[model samples]
Target: MATATLISTISTNLRQPTATFQPKTPLLFRRRQVVAFESKPWESQEKVLRENAFVCAASRRNSNSSSSITVTDVSVSELDDKLRKVLQFVLWAAEGVYIIWLFLLPYAPGDPVWAISSDTINSLIGLSLNFFFLLPLANSVGIHLLDAPVLHPMSEGLFNFVIGWTFMFAPLLFTDRKRDRYKGSLDVLWGFQMFLTNTFLIPYMAIRLNKPDTKYTPRKDSQLGSVMVNGASVVGVIGGAACLISILWGLFGRSDSDFGSVADRWEFVVSYLGSERLAYAFIWDICLYIVFQPWLIGENLENVEKGKVNIVKYLRFVPVFGLVAYLLCLDVDEEV
Candidate 1:
């Protein structure tokens, strides 16, 4: 009975629940699991910082290079501007000196050479044509033909014409449109003066050198203007043709006692003026015409509509300067 009670007591002791404590999972571990489940993809902080630094360095290098180039270009441009101004000033001074010399030549001691030179220049200038031609006429009349009256008008006319033409035409050569009323009026005034004098052309050319290229617009012609242009052209052609025929007749056909042939008239002209003076005058006429004619054609062409293969423009290069022919054949745009 004791053994049985002892076994029962041991069994009861084993079967009875023991008072034992079990530890719970850590709070930090649970939080980490939740974060891992919810987290998005992200770059490493160190890698991001390195990439930003590289970009900043590249930008700095590019900025430094660009700034250096800009500084160099500015300095070069300033130098060129200064050089151009100096060149222009020198040219202007030279031209002024020449003009003054030409004015003073008449008062200078009259050597035979100088007198002959002056007479020759006067003959080609057209100012003294009446004077020279009138000399023979004056011989027929009672008056004696003198060099003073002839030379004075010739020199004065040439100088005045140069100045007037230059100033009047400069603005026209450079600008396509005149938006300013004051400037437009000034241009008109200059143009009017050119018709009278033609000497202001020198200053006009100087002014043009400093001007920028302007955008050109073609001008439309009106009915009356077109009619006038055509009429003028036709008249010019007829007059030119007559003039040419007259010259050819004088050169070849004329058998007058005085001024019989082209050669005879040329000899008379040379004898009347002087070889040195005539030569200089001829040279100046040729040079001035050569220099101015191209610009004149260009100015006229600017207002005309362009098309493929303009034969008339090409014909400008023909001998005898082709100026008369050009004027006769091609109608200039009259809108401007």
Candidate 2:
């Protein structure tokens, strides 16, 4: 009885030990999971920062290259921007002056931009065509716009070929800047939008052949991406050729009426002085427009006395509006 009492007393005094602890396995696993989750993003952030630093350094190295003489030093992007701004400003200002003068020709101050008469817009339609075709040829006849010097008796005729090319080339410029207000553009929707990557060929040539046979491709992609790019490139070339051909056809396919001689004929003088017939004005406009091409080209040509005028790009269109007006006149002639 004494022994049994003593054992019972010991058991009661010591409560059973509960399962309370682990070997720290779960805690270790949780810590490892958190580190792994954070590592990938951290590595990515580091890579981005390093890349940005490299670019920043390269740009700084190139920023002042034009001041010195070196092949790689022209600061190409900056030069292009400067040219663009200058061009845009010149174009807008000239257009604005001409439009205003045309709107209020009779009362406007001293001969505002070619004495633009306040003719109705309706009269101006189709007039642009004349500038596109005849002016170049008339220029061939020695009546250069602004009465510019006739390089030769046949200068105007010789100029016709260049003007034809410019007119036929109308399509690509339209596509490149579709928002631009030119006619015959909407009809070409979904007609295999050209890549004009061939135009980039000029830049590539500038970099490659200009250099020691170095190439112009930027970083290459994966094999699949490369294949896709090459395919798109080929398609671009074909589409550009098609567009060029179509535009060329329009300029070259002049009617007998187009190539007809107008000087000294009653039809010519009557067409010039008569009522606001769309056709006559259109023909005259084309003549004057092409007449003006050389003048505008001169404006773009660089001179030491004048600063560079890269912005002089497409200023040829300032006179083109006059040509379009002529085409509108033709529509009237057809109607009567």
Candidate 3:
């Protein structure tokens, strides 16, 4: 009777609807791929656990690993540290480029360019370009701010131009990695480059985008001299305000209906042998080079080495004098 009942039950299960499928547990239905794990009975599982522990420890050393690792071997989170280092590097690159292009290059007298441009584009281009900048590239060709020759001796204007943009471009390589900040900066750069390429759009965009409480506020809480930087901004603001006041005092509130008056006053103050601005800019460049540049570069170099990504040690081989030449005309003078 028992055998007959068991057979009947088996037949019933087999005859059940063909479409019905049984649910599978992981261990029951998993496809078994053949992998050779050779070890003494009872030892293979132990070996795997030991190997896994070693792997967990080794992964902790990765620079990109999280700072927040745990015994369960969660990867270390370096989000903050890596980002800070990257931001510093971006700033260094921007500042270094600025010093070379704006400050040093411009220091050379403008007579060469002035003579070159004198006829066609010079007279008008200088007035247009020298709106705020002191370097009257146009004036060198033949333009006057107010019956006075409007030229910044080349170097003074170049320095300001480069330094100003250095701050603007610094954040590009910086990965606050904060998506919102990153997106905001990308927008600003796009806008800036657009304006640079087309000067006529400036007034239109200014009106369209510049609502004091609404559109004009800086996109992100930034690090450069913004209130975002604690001590630095405070110091910079006070000094910057003072300089701005002095500049306006010399520049505006005039009835002469002059065109390049603002540009002329700036050149008078920053030109070499004219004001201390050249020396001052050079000094700041040196401070940045010696104190900040090396450390930032070093951090990146180390990261490359540790990552096993090959790098030329050309930076190490570079002479310290290269940096020194930045603040003073060391290279130019020494060669001369």
> Deviation in angstroms for 258 in model 3?
26
Determine which window of 10 residues in candidate 3 has minimal summed lDDT: 327-336
Computed on alpha carbons, the lDDT of every model, listed in order, comes to 0.43, 0.35, 0.36
How do these models rank on TM-score, best leading? 1, 2, 3
By TM-score, is 1 or 2 better? 1
Report the lDDT tens digits of candidate 2 across residue range 1-336.
Answer: 999999997776444222122456575444434343443577776675564565566676767765443534457756766775665565455445444443345443222334534653322322332333444356557876733222211112222322333332222222221112222222232121111111221222122212222343333233433332234324334433433433443333333324333232335334333443222223333444354433434432332112223333333354433222222111111101
Error of model 2, residue 280, in angstroms: 9.5
Residue 76, candidate 2: Cα error in Å is 4.2
- Model number with the top TM-score: 1
Model 3 stretches astray by more than 4 angstroms = 1-75, 78-135, 143-158, 164-179, 182-282, 285-336
Please give, for residues 1-336, the per-residue lDDT of candidate 3 as tens digits: 999999998877656532243455342222111112232455765665564565455666654635534523532335545655566565556645544543455453332222333432453354345443433333445756644334332333343332332332222113121223233454454345322321211122222222134334345444441322223223333333333432443455232435346666566545542333333444444344343333323333322323222332333223232212121211111101
Per-residue lDDT tens digits for candidate 1, residues 191-301, read 554333223434444444463535544335335334434554453444344334434533442243343555665565445434333333333433554555455555455
Total clashes for model 2 = 25
Count of clashes, each model: 18, 25, 10
